[model samples]
Target chain A: MKLINILSEKKEIVLKKWFDKIAASYPVNAPSFLKNQKNQFANPVGYTIEETIEAVLDVLINEGTDKKAQEFLDRFVQVRAVQDFTPSRAVDFLFMLKQLMKDELKDELQEKGMYEEFLLMESRIDRMVLASFESYLKYREKIYELRVNEFKNMAFRLLERANLTFEFKDDDPAFEKDVSDSDNVK
Target chain B: MPNESKSDELKQDELVKIDYKPPKKDWMDTPVHFRHGTYIYPAKAKNLTYLGLPNPREWSPADEDWKLPDNWKDIILNGMKERLDKYRSFKVFMDICVRCGACADKCHFFIGGGDPKNMPVLRAELIRSVYKGNFTAAGKILGRLNGARGLTKDVIKEWFYYFYQCTECRRCSVFCPYGIDTAEITMMGRELLTLLGCNVNWVIEPVANCYRTGNHLGIQPHALKDMFEMLLDDIQDRTGVKIEPTFNRKGAEILFVTPSADYFADPGIYTCMGYLMLFHELGLDYTWSTYASEGGNFGLFTSHEMIKRLNAKIYAEAKRLGVKWIIGGECGHMWRVMHQYMDTMNGPADFLEEPVSPITGTRFENAKSTKMVHITEFTADLIKNNKLKLDPGRNDKLRITFHDSCNPARAMGILEEPRYIIKNVCNNFFEMPENTIREQTFCCAGGAGLGTDEMMEIRMRGGMPRANAVKHVHDKHGVNRLTCMCAIDRATLSTLMEYWVPDVKVTGIHELVANALVMKGEKERVVDIRGEALKEKKGEDNVR
Candidate 1:
């Protein structure tokens, strides 16, 4: 069987192993809890990780991305973006997929003489990593936008519109600092 | 520097090291990472000074020296001891945990963010360890083995990070066999931090504003009246009933006080209009208290003492106005304060009569002691008695689900009132997943004064469980509208919904209530309080 065909058969094991790799990224005790990934409500992070990784793996096998696949990636990357991960670490799970594919199915690809399929799959994972980076940045940017929008979402804009906001006059003593000013006033 | 944690320096390399191995250090020994988005800004010196809180100084958490009082250690220890003595519950909670870890996965923060310390039990242990080390002989003798750590400045920093991280929503307490109120523990942790002036700006600034003005936002009476006039304008445009609510009037039958957010904030302003429409329809006798404009108490986030000081104004205004009883608007922690703490903290409401809905003649037996009835309970009773003519079809455009806010659900046991009102008011209403509603309800993750902007990342992470449940229904039953009964939920869950489930917009329950309320001689209602046209077709995704 070819490497892609073998991956199709071994998809379940590959998913479980890939889920383990992502779980390893979290803190120690958290993984033990996240390892029980069946219940979605109780262990949302685990469930999302399992579900999204499975979907991302399937997308890689098809050698492209779809809306559903991108959404799965979006949801997963959204979780990581807000988490304690840096930009690279947030999307590094995609890179981990390439490493896992190599480690898990290395001999199978070598024996099957399908370096081209392996390269194609690796590049696709690479592309997915790039896509995950896009999603991660989208969420991070969304968080900052949400922060700004938070102020506007309140009675703030209305306050400004109604001219209720107290603006300091340019000539006001409080607005203009004198030469003999104390830093403590700030 | 003390601020730059060892864990942070090695975080990037340590995170991507993809080997199946143990955590680098024990959780107890693990230094906390004060990442930018994870923490809130420190309380500003002015806000702390305005509140007369201790150790007011301008310093950042990332600084080498926090400018804590020289005797900060003694201050925190003494404060802890004082609280442990005064509140026996604190002492019992400090000693009683078996750490079976029932609450580990229950925390929304931990469930969403996967942070180990965000676990309710461990978060409680963040302070409880110090309680053990300083208070218990066993902990002092046994040290880290007994899960006891000293109250170092690092420990205080960890406390500020973790305690404020909690929304005090009490979801984890629902699962605890010992029935430990983790929210109280968080409150205690915050109280000790307050001694060192180590509270968050989001919380302390609100407390200060509430202390000076009657509300957290510090809207003066004229501005408050102006805001109400704006709402009345919206009400006139929508319903054509000119609401003439008396502010701080003498001898109104009922004193109506809501979180000031209702008068000003988005979506909450719609709920405020809903209250106006309902009152107008029923001819309910109530006066707004400009002095007690805030029903939500940020003092509950600060200290028990502060809760009393901020809460005293409510009763004082009720007395001064001589309203027979008080009707609090839809707010979560406000109700938690009114129900659980208000009666004891600033009570003997002997000045006011028991709350009886003047329209329906149904006495609010639940709030007989507090003399304050929740709007939902009042509205529910009105619907129950068929006193108000509610056109349920008016809400035909929306499919709704009730998000039982954490305080109202867990703290106050207000499970049925909102459901009763929703069923009587709306056409299509659905419950979220079995575990995510009622007493097992997840928090908006923005309660207990953590509902600020800089902590958006943590809030998003913490809101995941609530959003995930909302998503479940949004996918399953086309739940386009998420109606909650909290002011914080109104302001914050809108952001959360915007982030997690973008299509689902949040509404206060009364906003739905008034949409169906048949007002007296009102014009043909075309628009909801938000100026969105009623009976508009549900477009592809949130086409409002």
Candidate 2:
């Protein structure tokens, strides 16, 4: 397969998971918040929903696109991982979007008598998309690890040719077992 | 008749000897005491060679194969003249100095030899006259009036000889109120001479060889390793101390350093042995890097870029070893390059931890943490802090006088450190007169790459002043031993002392200290009046 086709396929998988999470947190009363034609009335609920989706896209694209930006995000993620940030933070991001939209649209919804019904529908969709986004973030980490391992292998080969010695800890069980068996035979 | 024939045969042998003695009454007669005996005539001619004013008729045009361009002579003359003018300091010094002669007596050579040309002002005038004739309109118009002559083969020879005579000691500048540095003028003259392909074979050949190989001695890595191993064995045999001089060991706590010459030549290896023994005795963690082993920068004799290239290895090796500090062995220009120029050229070291003496717990105040240290200072501090158990009586009967090297004393202000170490180790110590010590000291005449046999006449003439001072004390106080800190000074002065005054001996200060070091269970390590080892074991087999 062409390299670009493979990259695009992987990017589509990542983007779909992100877009579904945003759609799930969409307000049921978003149309009401967008009303009052020719008036300067604040549409806080619609604005909140848009801003949250934009922030998530900014984070995802910053990590997934620009090479330097991705490296920086990887470094940040590694540091956060050391500090024990779990994969469940993706669910918390969805819940924050819902809370902001509810608070913003409550006054207008109350005037229309539709506040309780809209919140109930919005929350049910949030759970389904949050689960998918969490799994996508885990898959992104795996891809990063594979690329780093390939780079390290090339560096080791070059260093060997230069007559420099570098020994790493035996982390791969199969490779370690093979080396130990060869040593025993020798 | 047969006896008469035997007498005739004896007479023929006597006749062949031909009383080649001087005339009874001569015009060039020196005082009876001043007469130099058998070697005096050759020695006088040698002194005259240092004046560097050759006879013009000796010049011979080159053969066709190596013949210079027809206009090459003129081109060189004009180029040098223009360069002399462009140098602001040189121009200022040439035009400004009145014949006050305030700097006359200040030069160690002048005071020692009593030669007028050895005076700083007169020595500078030799080159300045050539400058004036070529550069100035007045000088060109009235050549005889300005004492400038046309550029000739004779002038080229004179430039080679006299310019090399100046050691670039910078002692004369101290007495100049206008602060005219004669050393700078000497450098310019030498540089111009080099451009005309006129360089002393001894200095230039070694420089070329060093460029090809990594060291002045032209010893490659294998030879260097072998020499170090040999010296290590010799050290163990001599001092009964086994020292493993580790090579290229990464993450060693310190880097044991020495001049590259030590890895190849004599007296240098002895000093290297001294360093190894001291390090071993202290039980310090250090390693030798073949890469950064050369401490002496020959480039300092020629150009700045060469200096940078030679010195680049030290810090690179320091980074490679992950060491805390670099400890340099006993060398002259090595310390000068490290103490003066290294940081400015290859610095801002981030990896180095600030040095606090392991024994004393006192920090070096003005020193860069990563830069360098003279081994004398390090060892002296150890002795001062009561870390090294030394017995002063070990050096008894070795009446010693110290000759300060120009670079270390004048350039680095390293006067007291070596002296302190020497005094602590030796029971009897003497310093030269105050004027001849420290910053005011004269060079051993073979400094600045002028240490060659072809230049021996000039070297001795230049060193006559220093030799005379040493003779004065030797005559008065019976002081026979001269201890110096610089390797060049030791090498040059040893040659000079052998030829000029054979009664005295010259040796490195570390050699004296190493000789005097009190080994475990040895009562003393002193040399008796006759220069015999007094602490020899009974029935010990003599190897040499």
Highest DockQ scorer: 1
Docking class of 1: acceptable
C-alpha DockQ for predicted model 2: 0.00
lDDT of 1 by residue, B122-215 (tens): 8988988888899999999999989998877788888888898999999999999999999999999999888988888989988899999888
What's the TM-score of each model vs. the native? 0.92, 0.59
Off by more than 4 A, model 2: A1-186, B1-95, B105-117, B133-153, B263-266, B346-355, B519-532, B535-544
Second chain alone, TM-score for each candidate: 0.94, 0.77
Displacement of the residue B13 alpha carbon in candidate 1, Å? 16
Write model 1 residue lDDT over A1-186, tens digit each, in one string: 777777878898888888888888887678888997468887888989988988887776665456667789888998898888778778888777777777778778787468887887777777677888899999899999999998766646567425567655445787456523765566
Worst 10 residues of 2 chain B by lDDT: B34-43
Chain A TM-score by candidate, in order: 0.79, 0.32
> Which has the greatest TM-score?
1
For candidate 1, the per-residue lDDT at B319 reads 88
In every candidate, what fraction of the native interface contacts is reproduced? 0.61, 0.00
